[model samples]
Target: MPRISHPRSSSTPLHEGGELALIERIRRRAGGGASTALRLGIGDDCAILRPRAGEDLLVTTDFSLEGRHFRRDWHSPQSIGHRTLARGLSDLAAMGARPMAAFLSLALPPAVARDAGWLEGFLDGLLDLAKQHGVPLAGGDTSESPSEQVLADIILLGSAPRGRALRRSGARVGDLIYCTGTLGGATAEFAQVQDGRGGKTQTASSMNPHLFPQPRLAAGQALLRRKLATACIDTSDGISTDLAHLCEASGVNAEIDAASLPLHPLAQQLTQEAAMAAALHGGEDYELLFTARAATKMPRKLGGVPLTCIGRVVAKKRRAPQVTLIAADGSRSALAAQGWEHLR
Candidate 1:
């Protein structure tokens, strides 16, 4: 079992009127109005979606748990809501899909259940992001948790053009590896939050990447449209582990150069070991990692986000390992799959 932790007894209480009343409040806050595709949305037994013509449906679900994913002291209700939904959306982005709708199921703690303001703030964060992405909150379930922690599950539905969804199996030998955005910010954020240095390190300008990650939806869409990537995945788990998954799927090996990693500036402020460790093993970056042909020309930026080439995919010889890490001095070693993992 995961370790248990409690939120400080400080925020608004959830509505005592219970589940049905909570549902209505969330429905209103979600702005689930009738649309042609959604003939029946929140009020229905199940949401009905009239799929877009010639598109493939993509569905992904993600969960956010209290002690496992966040602490109420470290995260605001609004940030928590935004992040939970964002986690599901990031999965869709990996497949180059456009968001269509979302379903949210919440198991709220008693303290939060009795707090109307807390609920409102949470819904506002979730709904606002949904609106921004043109994904309406279609339908969901709600209940008070039997314990002190809150648990949330988000199911996001998206669509991509027929036969165009990106996967981790298409990369081939000699393809160049690419990643969007800097690495290490989320790692730094995690250290500050979990090590009890959050108050000392965090500021309005220096936001935690773990708390506020921008999924690479636009970059994924652009890559799909331009047919630029042979394989794609998001950098949710640390790059070393996630890239290992991609390499295994594609039946290839990878060589990542330590010097080529595009690290967050904050990485420079840390010890050399910490920076490199975070760059390799820290998770929750939520950026894009893709493989493209070596000769294929790529734009310097996608959707105003820099796209940097960091490594290359190679055909694995018999008994060869999946990934190799190249040090700054060009020495090579078998890459360790030591990134973040659940229950680790």
Candidate 2:
């Protein structure tokens, strides 16, 4: 709850950006793009997304709920907005889908509903990412919520060349597992933010992983376009847990070399067990997790982010767990699929 602030500035009156007017401003601010995939965007009853010839459309939605996913005292409106959209984009990245259009449904509590500046700040964060990704803002509904929290649901529409989108079920025995960037930062960031509540100063730097997570869009595109990966997924649910998803879908078992993990520098400061747990089980890093045939060579870095090979695919026996971890001392143990759950 560090750096908490009201959604609006105290100097401005609440009526500056009314509902209709605010919607119009958002529509205009989102007009910088000219993506061909969009046939109709904002200001319509329904948005239209046109997939390219021989391409398949992909759609994903993410819900951002106040109090559960975010605490008003912990997140700025802008950061909340950015992270909400980023969650859906991360799903698209996992499938190597090219971003096309987005739909946002915002339900605001009465207190924050009238704060035009707060709404603008939130839209600014969302639209800035839309422009950067070349994804147009499409139509979605907005309403006042009776609850005391803000809720946002973002639906992202994307496309991938016909039959080329990555899937969790594609991994085969002998495939090498790779992950992008460092792990465990989001866990640390979450803890730091929670600890600094009540207006206490923050000890974490501005580059807190929770506040600013980049979708591995380019890396995912490369994986599919180049046929480099046999399977793919994003790491919002933690490495250990997501790996289980991949293995279960592919009907395989996995072995991760704990020492080979691309650990965050902060891991060095934590106790050994804590560092390992955080790196393997922390959530929301939004990095890409992929599998490639052992014979295939992959880039050491993509989009300036390092990719480290940490594990490999193995055949799964009936009644066996989907994942296992190998310690530095060569001890092996079942890797539990424990991570952040939206419903938990």
Query: Which number leads on TM-score?
Result: 1
lDDT of 2 by residue, 180-246 (tens): 9889877766677787732222222325677667788988998888899999999999998889888
lDDT of 1: 0.80
lDDT of candidates 1 onward, in order: 0.80, 0.79
Cα lDDT of model 1 by residue, 1-344, tens digit: 01112335633334467566777787777665334456557776677789879999999999889888877777777778878888988898888888888888888877888878777877776776676678888888776676799899899988999999999999999999999988988888767766666523221222556766777889999999999999999988889888988988898999998899988876767898899888888878888899999989999999668999999999898867678889999899887777865221
Candidate 1 regions with alpha-carbon error over 4 angstroms: 1-15, 32-36, 195-207, 342-344
Which lDDT value does model 2 have at 53? 88
Candidate 1, residue 270: Cα displacement in angstroms equals 1.5
Candidate 1 weakest lDDT stretch, 10 residues: 1-10
Off by over 4 Å in 2: 1-18, 197-206, 341-344
Model 1 has a clash total of: 8
Reference-based TM-score of each model: 0.90, 0.90
